[model samples]
Target: MSLIASSLTFMKTPLTAKLNTQLKLFKIKVKQNTMHTLNSILRMRRDIMKLLIIHPHLSIIGGSERLTQILVYELEKKRKNIEILVLTGSRNKELFPETSKIKFKLFKEAPVKAKNLRIKKLINAFLTLSEVMDDFCPDAVLTMIQEPIYLVLSKIVKPSIGTAI
Candidate 1:
């Protein structure tokens, strides 16, 4: 009985040691695998040189409006093809020359002078532009016109470039 007890105790010591070693190895392997996956994702994004920018609304106003315009310039400067699909465009469409490849689609266009009824405009605009977006399916959707539409679409869509989509 004493001999049996000694053997069982010895077996358990080695068994627990093996388990602990396996656990350490598994932890190291998991971290390496996670890092490898993250790097691959970043590399894939970098490989994509082409970009589609969808601005839900844009008009000659606000800091966001200015930022959106600047981002387009930066993307274009990087030689990434910029497809500016505006669901509701402003008078600034003329800002980019006709020669530019930037395609402009306007569900609603701004008048010379604008009033602040953007929320109402967005609700109405979404109806017409939804079809356009389905067809266009841009890489990112930038919301120059701050409403819930961009958020809704982006949730289902990936690479939704909030910077200037």
Candidate 2:
């Protein structure tokens, strides 16, 4: 018989009653330790809030771009402890002086004259966003515009990430 089976047999004897009680206590201690470790992990996750902002394109100065810039500025001002990262398909930071300090991960711009430009842009955005999500592991994602790709990617890559449009 296996050591565990032999131990079970031995534990059944009246003489080993104290050993069986100790084993039960030991199991309880292991369970408590496991619970404590899991709680610590959850508390650590709560301590650091990471926010990822997805903007497909920031090359031009537009209403949506301005709103994103303003949102980043306000978030930085108010949430000092929260980490923020902006993921964009293309960016011309010079166009927005207000967002000069914002952290941005810019994806390679698709060739203007290339065929299937829209498809290429979409693919690039999806891949880059996936990489960013893996590396940063943001707690939440915010998008200035209604982009289904962002929502879909967040669900695929990290379902735990809360997405806000």
Candidate 3:
């Protein structure tokens, strides 16, 4: 099994300090158990032009969650037609006012000020994403922060273009 899968097994074992420690060791900080489809996401690089990057909050500010911003920038730079649609996990906007452009959009129910209710954010992201997909039809929608929820949603809505970073 891969590191991710093993991590999942460890997580499912139980909820305890040991499990929490294991989750941290493996960086298993996701909102859902949708990671079973990660392998498909790895197969996405075979095609690149039709890409859609997903993020829960899509914040372009200072936070440990800057990986989302990095994903957007990297994809945008590599593919000129990249469209970043944020499935916002935060209640507030993660905006870089000086750098605002048409590249990003949010699907958040409420603005999150802190990381208290992570599961709620993931649920919000999932609910909003279904509607967002119908409007913004892309060949492939991708993400890294939202983990399995984003990956599975992308696959269901359209082709998923995932990458390992």
Candidate 4:
């Protein structure tokens, strides 16, 4: 009985070692596949020009809004095949006619009384921008104003995305 137990233990040790080796090889293969997929995505994005333009708000037609409008027009004119997506907090659709790609991150007034609404709004904006960046994966980010929030969020979300103020 003791000899049988010893032999069983010896077999278990080799089986466990073999399982561990297989697990390690599987992990390595998964890592390589992930890297290859990432490289392919990067290469595909590089082939197309995707621009993400962030504006604070376009509720009213101001100088900044006009500049943004002109910039988008000129960019589209220059690069016919370029893809542009405009992100804003709030916008008047009448003023900003291009509604196809313009995304709004509107923050409704919280029902519960909050101490700092500004902070809450900032957090909401950051999260929204992060989602946009992840989905769009823009090659470059163009911000109309000198908003540090956009700059910081863009860098944090995707460091590869170039930001131009």
Q: Could you say which candidate leads in lDDT?
A: 2
Q: In model 4, what lDDT does residue 118 have?
A: 79
lDDT of 1 at 20: 59
The true-structure Cα RMSD of candidate 2 reads 7.3
lDDT of 1 at 83: 52
**TM value for model 1:** 0.45
lDDT (0 to 1) per candidate: 0.57, 0.77, 0.54, 0.76
Predictions ranked by lDDT, top down?
A: 2, 4, 1, 3
Full candidate order by TM-score, most accurate first: 4, 2, 1, 3
- lDDT tens per residue, model 2, 27-98: 899999999999999987688678888887899879999998888878777865667788876787686443
- Candidate 4, residue 59: lDDT: 86
Q: Please give the distance, in angstroms, between residue 19's alpha carbon in candidate 4 and its true position after superposition.
A: 48
Between 2 and 3, whose lDDT is larger? 2
Q: Which portions of model 3 miss their true places by more than 4 Å?
A: 1-50, 58-64, 91-102, 110-123, 158-165
Off by over 4 Å in 4: 1-45, 99-114
For model 1 the local lDDT of residue 68 reads 65
Clashes of 4: 0
> Can you tell me which runs of candidate 1 are displaced by over 4 Å?
1-57, 108-123, 153-165
Per-candidate TM-score against the hidden true structure: 0.45, 0.61, 0.43, 0.63
